[model samples]
Target: NLAALMRIKRRELLLILLVASQFGCIALGLVWGASWLHKWLAQSFELRALAEAHATTQQVAVRLTRDGTKNFEPGTAGWERLQSLCERTTVPYDGHLWALRRDTGALICHPNLHEDPSLLRYSLGRLPIVSSGRAPTLLEAINDAEANDEEIASGTIIVDGALQLASAVSLPGTNTVLLILQPYAHIAQAATDFIAPLEQIGWIFSFGVVGATTVLTVVLINRYEDTLAQSNAELERKVQRRTQSLLSTRNAVIFALAKLAESRDKDTGEHLGRIRSYVTILAGELARSHKEITHQYVAELAIASSLHDVGKVGIPDSVLLKPSRLTAAERRAMQLHTQLGAECLASIQKQLGDDDFLELAREIAYSHHEHWDGSGYPCGLQGRQIPLPARIVALADVYDALTSARPYKRPMSHAAAREWIASRYGSQFDPEVVEAFIGREAEFRRISEARFGSAASECDDSESTADSPANEEAIAAIAAGI
Candidate 1:
């Protein structure tokens, strides 16, 4: 089933099939060719054996003729001497050399008579005859040899339970024939030895072809897999680049919307930018001490902090633009801006699904004004009840307001603003967030000065307030105004 599920292209599959077919054909060819070669070698070896036996018989006939016994009478001493000469001749390759009485098919003598004395007792006619399917009998073989002008006649026979190749040759000038018998098993073994090197060569060729094919196939598959891996890596990189581009565009849109809300108060110059930088710095520093403050959290917090004042867009222009401190009802109306901004962002988040940026913005907008002691605003959320992003933005918001020029007051110096924030720790802000702000106060001041010019080092007398409910409301109003 896994093989069935594998996705091989038609071209690749076809190439594999073709290669396998070629290997099969090559293997079959090697087997068939080896068989043919073996048969050829066997036939050639048999022919050479027969020719050597015939030559040995001819040499014996020549030796007898040189002894002046070629035309000797049958029962004469010279004839007996010629028979003794034939019996004394040494045969090569364990062959049997003997003579036969041609006219009556009687045996004369043999070189191996001592090993097989029965051969001297029978004439060719009396010897046991054996046939191998369409082959001639010994008598018929002798007749064939005589008819063929006394040329050597070769045939195979079973003698004493062993197969033998018998070659018969007529004597040159006598009524006698020379026969040489070699064991068929011995000739067969010689033929096998003769072709052993050739068989080895065939095996090596077969193995080489198969091994080369396997190596080539493996190399090709490896190359194909490497190419596929590179393609997947390239595709992943392209997707990441496109995703980053889309996120950049979305962030640009979010910032533009936040800036639109900030535009309601002309005095809020670069307020959103300063808040982003401050929240980023505070969250970055807090990340070192808190596992929850991750790089992603810090980045989202920076973008979300800009929307802390987005709710002010819902306030009436009269109350929002008032140069003096607001009445209780006017301040209450302005406070509803927090809920308005949160609701607006929540609706957008529902349409966009659960986006991290929009979710953080909604939380910061609704809860940044909430206090650490449950006394700060629309909801009396205490301590950690306030979202981390909201608590972080709370300190950043108050610090920026104290240091920037507002419609109701001149800018306070960096030292005065720092003192004001330090005094409110644990009551107006999360202690950890306050600590992070204090530790990185210099970076915060740098960001503030970079956006709005450095504030004069003088504190205004009217900006200082006593710790009372009336003064707290005024301070809360000023902190939320930005």
Candidate 2:
């Protein structure tokens, strides 16, 4: 259930949890170990202080006995001698040394006799005597020592509310014990000094471990996310490549279909190719200033322009192939080609649903023959009323028609065609489109010559090329005027 709740993979989730648990255990162990170490160190320090104090007191007791002042009798020469001897003796650990009466538990002589008389009075008045516990008082330790026939006794006690450690040794052949007192504060200080560095080290080590773990976790997560992002980017690139391949295949099929229709009109040599190139040049120039004419639109327009005259396929061969000028009836029939081509593309688009390239093709096929002044055929769309693709194809088609040789007439030179189109700027052509064409006339001449050779010379009466032999009779009758 826990695994199902997590969105991550089970293996990754388990790995994260395991790492977290390990760190948690390590932190818990550090805390528990540090506490145990502190307690152990404190107990050891207390025991060590007691042992050292007992040994030093025994040495003091030995020295007193050797001096023959074992019996401490006040106002006696022996007591005075004992006092003088104690004053001369060097105490260890800067401690206070005194003699206590075993029977009364009274402090008899101390080294602070003259310096602090009241302190000696206080010590002699209420010397603490604990009977039980691990830290017995000085009197209790001495009693136990006497019963056990021990020479030394040591324990902790409270004197005037200050904790102190006391050690006593019975002076041989005397009713006295030599006692040494040291403040518990001194022992506590030693223990604190010993444990302080360890505590600091423990804390530093714990923080270092946690900081390192945090840094490692952050680095690992970043690396994983980067890897995931790279994988997603690579997947998108592959999908784009596949999509581009499919689009290329669809474009090739469209161009082939347009070429099939052109095959019916033998006089149009490389007509689709020149028209597509001319449209590209004009659209590219317009793109520099026209916001609507983007690079993508220009590219789609180039391909769609090839199908501009595809409706010619629907015309009867007799009218469409007529060598001479068409009659009004045949002209009207020829005009129907525009509507027929639009309907053909519209049907394809209906099957395929809305498509950018096919929609543009239908618009161009239907409206390319329309005039800017509304004098053209089909729907008679004028000016901006015609779609931009259709407007672009219109100029490209007229340019190709004027420059290329036809079944009836000679081809016009690039200069003559340019002037002819420019002459009808607002009527037969869009003023803006004619201006764009004027700027790129040199490119137009290059494309025309590359596709259909140099423009045909002015037609000479005796040098006219013959039409197909199958239509010679109709052509000879039509050629009578020439």
Candidate 3:
């Protein structure tokens, strides 16, 4: 009982209290900010959908009514019957229809109003056939002319406590204004029904991220528990707790971010981790040789390296994962990934409030493909003009990619990858990173030999990652294997 009590008791309360104390301000800020953000995004989405629906529905209505009237030949008996039939259909069909008379500017029909007949007359009286309102009127939305006819447009409105989207237009040379209101209940049911399932998916995703964060927080906290334990102030303990919470949030956020890139490409989170390792090794080698680079710079290179392919998200799969080499046009399109990656970094940075992380990420994303000699795109920065992290990751990313086989290409050996890096040292890659590779030849050899192995040089286009050394061990066990 005592054991159970201890397990259930004071520590959790203290932890909660401590977390609330340290991160209360931040936690409150985060939650409040998230709530506002969700609402803003939803409203914006709803508005856009509403606007599109309005335009489409109006255009379609105008085209149909105008064309239908012109096609009605007055000499034929079929024309009268067709006109009558068209008139009948104009009334709201189960709240999805409105019939306008072509000969007279009159509201001719509505759903279920046909039976009473008297009620239709009253509706026609109150309903203005045309309005002087400054806002877009039905006429503007559903424009039907002889040569250029637009389609009937649909829009959302609330009528008699019911929500509906109406589509209406008129025929050319006719006074009739055709209108239809798709009831809000049906539209909402159709629109919102899919969201519940999606929300569930989102909920599971959110929880999964939270769960992963919890594990990471526990690991991080446990590793620094001794240090955390040394903190004397209740507030400091709270701050530490909050720090862990925020840190956990950060990890979750990063994982979610990686997932975004991963969703576009089948080889996601693993791909990011693999590239990060390559970036780290290459950066470590570079830092030792280049006085311009610092150890912190190397670490930043590793962290930001996960985002090198982040631009791939903006690239369509048809272009990105093509089995064969891209055409000049397609290749140019693919090159846009660098810019897209920068945009993504900028968006996240904007959201994250501009920090060193985002700053480094943006730099790496934009300039990683830049050449040492200004031949690389998007911008042709030469020599030290490129950011160190970008230059460092550029070499690392390509090296790992060459050694790691893909669907379309075979793996190159570490030696072969090195040669490739060497070949392009000044043209494709930073000369400094290349010199660093040569000067710290032993470290380079060790990192290569240890990570890829001595036989990696034997790997060719036929090689597969299934047995490659480019695949890295998990961070937790990197020490064990190394």
Which candidate leads in TM-score?
1
The pairs that clash in candidate 1 are 107-123
Per-candidate local distance difference test: 0.76, 0.73, 0.58
Candidate with more favorable, higher lDDT: 1 or 3: 1
Question: RMSD, model 3, all Cα superposed?
Answer: 20.7
Position 430, candidate 1: lDDT: 88
For candidate 3, what is the lDDT? Answer: 0.58
Candidate 2 lDDT over 45-135, as tens digits, reads: 7778667777767666666667576568777776776666566655433557777676666767777776776654544323554434554
What ranking of all candidate models by lDDT puts the best one first? 1, 2, 3
Query: Residue 112 of model 1: what lDDT?
Result: 56
For residues 1-482, what per-residue lDDT tens digits would candidate 1 score against the true structure? Answer: 65434545644685578667876887788778767877787777778887888888888777776766665455687667666766676655577776777776676776655567677666654344443354665667767667867676777766667877777777667777777888877777777787788778876876687778767876777578758778999999999989989889988988888988989989888888888888888989898988987887788789878888888888899988887678878878888989999999999999989987888899899998898999878788998889888998988888888777664556665766787788888977788988998899989877765654423423334445324455555455655543
Write down the TM-score of every candidate: 0.48, 0.46, 0.44
lDDT of 3 by residue, 1-482 (tens): 99657744655665566455545554555566555655565445455444554554455456556545544344354345444554455222144344554544244544454465553442321232222233344444454322255344445544556655555655445555555555545544444554556555655665565556556665775587557556656668788779869866875676567667767865332557666666666677666657866877666566677777678788888976665545667778878888998998898888879688778888988888887778777887888889888887777666555555455444456565566568776777777777776655555444444544645555544335423443322111111110
lDDT for model 1? 0.76
Candidate with top lDDT is 1
